[model samples]
Target: MSPDIVTDPSRAKRLKAATHAAHDRLDKSIMRLEPFSSIDRYALFLAVQHGFHQDVDALYDDPALDGLLPDLKHRRRLDKIAQDLADLGRTAPAAGSKPVLAGDLPTALGWLYVAEGSNLGAAFLLKEAGKLGLSEDCGARHLAGSPEGRGLHWRIFTTALDAVPLTQEEEARVIAGARAAFMRVQFLADAVFIPSPSD
Candidate 1:
């Protein structure tokens, strides 16, 4: 089943923006990966966006169905995601020159996956918080305040996730588990760093 079916369109749109922000951040993270630099940041960004669709597919067990993996294992998919990102960071030059960037498209995407994934995961966390009749403010505050070292924009994005609806304390427990699982996945994805090789 396609993963797009389950992903909220608005969420996907936000993910796209987040992906663009990552590309811009990469421009600063590594000067060599600039949009006009030898590297094609725009193409790389599109590739990373494509990776999101791939993630959605991985998330779904069937059309409109959740992933096959248990909620606790949701982060497990980060392994493949990191790999895909590493591939994205590298792009071939128009003249067929050697790959300009130290890493590939997947690596660039990896950076983005870390940011946007957290926001999405926070959404689930908020849902859980709502279940307990507790305002997601506690968790949302963490995200808003960038408690986990996330950026200001990301913190705000996480707070946005808290707006969703979820009921029942038991459901909140499940969502919390999902949030924890998401953090694990984000950590794994963030750990994949491909340094530039020495000349």
Candidate 2:
């Protein structure tokens, strides 16, 4: 099932609209860092991924979220990301402060939405990793396509996400959580992708 096939009035659509600006800004910021310019730069990019995934690692196991999304546990990529870091001989960076969603299920869903949505783009990143001589079994495991494939995986998630019941206030929190998720990635990217003194 392609995501395009799932076009319905949905929380997924709403969240996408709400976070568009933040998402675009983060994309530009990451591109500015030129993460794919070299193996070293790609390693830094992996570190940023590790940091962000670590922040939301626990949410994959949240009972409430699991009930909402099918096979929620399988959606986690933190372990894959950690392995990718190790494959590059880089230690996984410590997770930053806890996510703003904390124990809030609605907000956590929002964060998960952003995290899961990123997988769709990972296909392209995985190609870039190929230029660095990294493959799914090597230094790019975290970016590999799921067995179900990216489009189907995303469609399944958004279908689940759009169906989750929330009040108007909770919906607002979901948007806030998504924006915060983007901000967190931007922060991590900035911290890890710092230019050398010669640059």
Candidate 3:
């Protein structure tokens, strides 16, 4: 079944609930790939991140979604990512180009769900970075938890997401957006680096 079908069992318009379920269902295999296990792997991860956000951050300018999630601009990490790549002697690759957003707010929020939720995963990834001697002050800014704190910031987004009243159809688009966001990350990951059979 398509991963987005996780949303099929969901009837509520609560974007948080639906999106969270989508992440849980779809990201397990991607997460298992352990993109931060080494500096090369980590750098590739950073490049793809830079590419994805550089592609999607324009969604922040969408007045419809911006009105709902104004702090969207404040959440950008492309600059941090570019610096991290530079520290690693890498450049923002051509792969860092724009991603497709389907041109609407709910779709943007679906993408936002993927982006913000990634921040919540930082506490774990930060430790992996530590294993490679990377830190918030040095080569791993993206894995550094949100400046405000991870859990609290995630709660703020989820609260806003759940509070928005979506139509049944809008909720579906949101789910589709979240799924697309995951696929983009996975696609870029494959573009930049993929573990060999022995790994």
lDDT per residue (tens digit) for residues 70-157 in model 1:
2222322333333433444533222211211212222222223343554444444434434433232431222222334335545443
lDDT digits (tens) for residues 103-149 of candidate 2: 79878987898899999999988898899899999999999988989
Most lDDT-accurate candidate: 2
lDDT scores in order: 0.34, 0.86, 0.73
Top-down lDDT ranking? 2, 3, 1
TM-score of each: 0.23, 0.91, 0.80
lDDT of candidate 1 vs native? Answer: 0.34
Off by over 4 Å in 3: 1-34, 95-98, 195-199
The digit string of per-residue lDDT tens for model 3 on 73-111 reads: 787787888888888888877644556563776778788
Q: Which stretches of candidate 2 lie over 4 Å from their true place?
A: 1-9, 99-102, 195-199
Among all candidates shown, the one with the greatest TM-score: 2
Clashing pairs in 2: none
lDDT of 3: 0.73
Residue 44 lDDT in model 2? 90
Weakest lDDT window of 10 consecutive positions for candidate 3: 4-13
